[model samples]
Target: MFWHRATDYILSSNYMAHRFCYLLQPGLIWTNVVMDSLIAASYLLIFLALFWMSSRLRQVAEINRYVWIFVAFGTFIVACGMTHVMEVITLWWPIYRFSTVVKTICAAASVPTAILFVRIAPALTRNMERFIFMLSTTQQEKDRALTSLIASEKLAVAGRISASIAHEISNPLESVGNVLHLLRTGAGLSPEMQRLVDSAQGEIIRAGDIARSTLSLYRESAAPVEVSLVPLLQSIIDLQAPALVRNNIQIQTRMRATVAIRAYPGELRQVLINLIQNAAAAIGEDGKIFVRVQPRRGGYSITVADNGPGVQPADRTRLFSLFFTTKGEQGTGLGLWLAHSLIEKLGGRIKFRSRTAGEAAIRGTLFNIWLPLGTPPYVPLAPFSSVQAGRRQMQKTASVASR
Candidate 1:
């Protein structure tokens, strides 16, 4: 029985081979060889592309949402390429059955690859939208950083100009102060003349102080010393009084505590001066500015409030940013930034609240400063008395002039 079956199988194979032998004719054989070679070359290119894409997918698999889908598609392409290879093999050898099996496997892979592509279409669209949003946000941040850098450069240039101006003004100011002193001491013609001289002297002295302060701002402090807050605040107010009066801005003060804090007095004074000046600038005629100082746990709080055109909501967030100003060309936009830096360096915090007109019950800005209290390492008390005396002299002269 085994011999009969073997002979039957050989006879059947030989009959089929002879039936297809006409395909081996020279012209047909050459055409078949060329077509098969072209198909093989096309399949080779497809296989290479799938291999490269798969390697790339593997590299970014963690971030890629449809990695599995891409991998399945690559597998389908590889299988399809293999079926083409099998087709090429069957042209040279009678492996038609093997070629049919390869095509069946390729068809199976293709179905799931198509299904996965359909399933991941929505995800790919969503990921594309997210990528676009992130790219836009990154571009915005880069633009903002570039703007800040330009502003910083401008600020540096301004500082250099201020230093040069201060130096030039200081010498002539000193000479004028000396001549004013001599004129005041030389016998006065009348009380009115004396009062005028005194007022002019006072203004000149204030201008000199401003120049000195401007120069000092660019330099480091000599040392941290105990500074009396009440006197410092009073002197700043006195210095700004002329401007406040000219603007018809009423001043009110409530000094609940006269605490001392270890700090750079010059810098602290600069902060207060900037705050007060800002308040005065915000207000119109008949505006009121209220300043208060109170003791807090381990520190003191200073509040400066004004009934002025309050800060706009949009400008609030960038209030302390360098060169961000609402004052247009009149402001250099350095006051608040410098104040913030000084306060932080002195181990203090400064905060402000503002409400625009018609937006709140009270329409104005309020600034609060908190400084840690500390005792002085050495008694540097002479300057306080002199400042107080000068303030008193100014008050007396103003009273006389008013009369």
Candidate 2:
């Protein structure tokens, strides 16, 4: 079979050469020339057979029809030109009157093929890019689903502690109310008793704060409030100050925009706290963290970055992937992913950039969160008594003032 194929190739090339010579003249009937043109034309038909076979292959395999069309037409026209060249070279030694005409016709046919390749190339590139993007988005979503499952498991464990924390809050809260009532009404209370009452009230207040902290970790949702950014950030910093100091992470905050956003202040606070803690954790000791806020197009942006060991090159791509942690056993990998989900729900975007190369632990990562302006505030369930409602608002005012 191999020998037969080789013999056929030899005769085909010889026939094409003879056809190249014939195209040079109109009526020159050299028998050898006529025979060779017939032979070359026959071989060119073989290329057509291959083209048809390719079409059948495409049909069976469900390959693209356009690709088959490009191959079919491209092969046919090039074969025609090859046969014309053969007649010019083998059938006639010198140039004939029609030689230049054949050249011009061949050149004209070649333009469409050249233009097709250029046009098709960009379309192919766009399709490949879209396919790759779709694949990446699907993988990310699957990772998020897995991460959420793991977090749900963690919350289940944490819920046991939450019940205890709530009880602890109720006991001291009742005692606080009793002592304050005694001081205000003073039913048989003495002057020195007032001092003791004040001291005891202070301690009761401290206990209530501890209880609040423990329970704060597990709020069902932060009640949306119209909150100013300055105080909100300060309060978070104060809460996290001890941890920041313990880790030797110095936080430098630069606020450029004084914007009042309608949002769940507590939830937003939690988001910042999570990001800040992660930033601090990234840096071991003597690391610097920068938290910057600025007004963006229609929203605000917050960037938290650390001067610590940056993310690994391979891990960078999967940074937001659920349960794919660079922190290994120490990292839950859900923090950033949850942060992303929360921010996105609030009409915001969170993005990160990590570098492992350069001086000063340029390996640190920068997380940017963009929250759009005019987002609606979160509304909590109504309080039972108007007095209690007034008191709660007053407490919020006090909290803002103290900050």
TM-scores of the candidates are 0.61, 0.49
The Cα RMSD in angstroms, rounded to one decimal, for candidate 2 relative to the true structure is: 14.8
lDDT of 1: 0.76
Tell me the whole-model lDDT of each prediction, alpha carbons only. Answer: 0.76, 0.68
Q: Taking the tens digit of each residue's C-alpha lDDT, what string does model 2 give over 170-246?
A: 69687776969677576777878877788777767656655665455454343455668777777677677877798
Best by lDDT: 1
Our tally of clashes for model 1 stands at 0
Q: Which prediction has the highest TM-score against the true structure?
A: 1
> Per-residue lDDT tens digits of candidate 1, residues 309-379?
89999999999987778889989888898788668767778999999877987799999999888632333
